[model samples]
Target: MRAFIAAICLFLLCGNAVANSVQDSTTPADAIVKALYDNLSAAYLCRDIVDADKYLKTRSVVEATMLAFTNKQDASETILKKWEDEIQINLKYQNQNISVEECNTLLRARTHQLYVAMDTLFK
Candidate 1:
């Protein structure tokens, strides 16, 4: 009876640990997505071509970064920080090269791509 109780306790603890670890791993991606979504929404609302371009570019960079992190599970914090910093620097110098219509089209495509990328992650 004592052995049975100990085994049950161990099973529960292991299960909980697995659940926590999975949640912990996903949290960073979730955060990055939320931040990107907010920025994109703001750009769309403000009708800012520069912001729209920045959003599209940042989205691609972040997706690539995440993919690289997944492929190499040992991605260091410095690498992730560098990627984030690069996005910030790029956004700071956004140019209004495209017209409003072009910006809209690009942002629309980027939003759909973001959804697809996030779906794959969640799966």
Candidate 2:
């Protein structure tokens, strides 16, 4: 939650002009690709999401997408922070008990979903 809030704060701090520019060049496909990349990565210190090698091409796609977003570093940091908060929230809901095993299960499920999404996208 804090990470996501921080990302939003940073984005706002960066100025509206940059945000507008980013939005103008960013497509829905680019956003989808970024979301998949974010979900597949352990952006947060929460847990590891495996099966990344299965979709190696996703990295390239995500890299290209990030470049399209104006500033790559800013976009990467912002998205990572957002994913950190998102993963934490998902872990809570997906595993109310919050067990390590449950976390592993959740991450695996998320990774698999992202992989499938990537396959569909890249194909």
Candidate 3:
């Protein structure tokens, strides 16, 4: 359990650090960007209640994700806000706390589970 949590936290940190890259929608890197939004949504959902240390940690992750998209730096704030808003809005009906399996499933998408995991783990 500890390792899983640590892995996911590391995943988010890695994802937060890897937002930039290949620009085409058809490219693999696009999936990583989409994955980043999913994470930012999760972080945004928890930021309201998590402790300052955790919040700040997650905030840095979010910031790094933004920095990864080098070309998208123009209007970066708006883009980040829009992505967070769109993804977070979809969570309006979800439970405040998510189970590990559920989160993994929603994020991994069956065949893409490995892809997402590897992307998050080493992006």
**Ten contiguous residues with the weakest lDDT in model 3:** 12-21
Ranking by TM-score: 3, 2, 1
Which candidate gets the maximum lDDT versus the true structure?
Answer: 3
Model 3, range 33-76, lDDT digits (tens) per residue? 54555455555455444433543564456456555543244444
Error of 3 at 88 (Å): 4.6
Tell me the alpha-carbon RMSD of every candidate: 14.5, 10.8, 11.3
TM-score of each: 0.33, 0.40, 0.45
lDDT (10s digit) by residue, model 2, range 46-67: 3333333533444444445445
Note the residue pairs that clash in candidate 1: none
Off by over 4 Å in 2: 1-71, 82-96
lDDT of each: 0.44, 0.44, 0.47
lDDT string for model 1 (7-106, tens) is 4333322322120123432433443344343334434343465455665565455446444434433332334344445444544325446677766676
Indicate the residue-level lDDT of 44 in model 2. Answer: 33
Model 1 RMSD to the real structure?
14.5
Give the clash total for candidate 2. 0
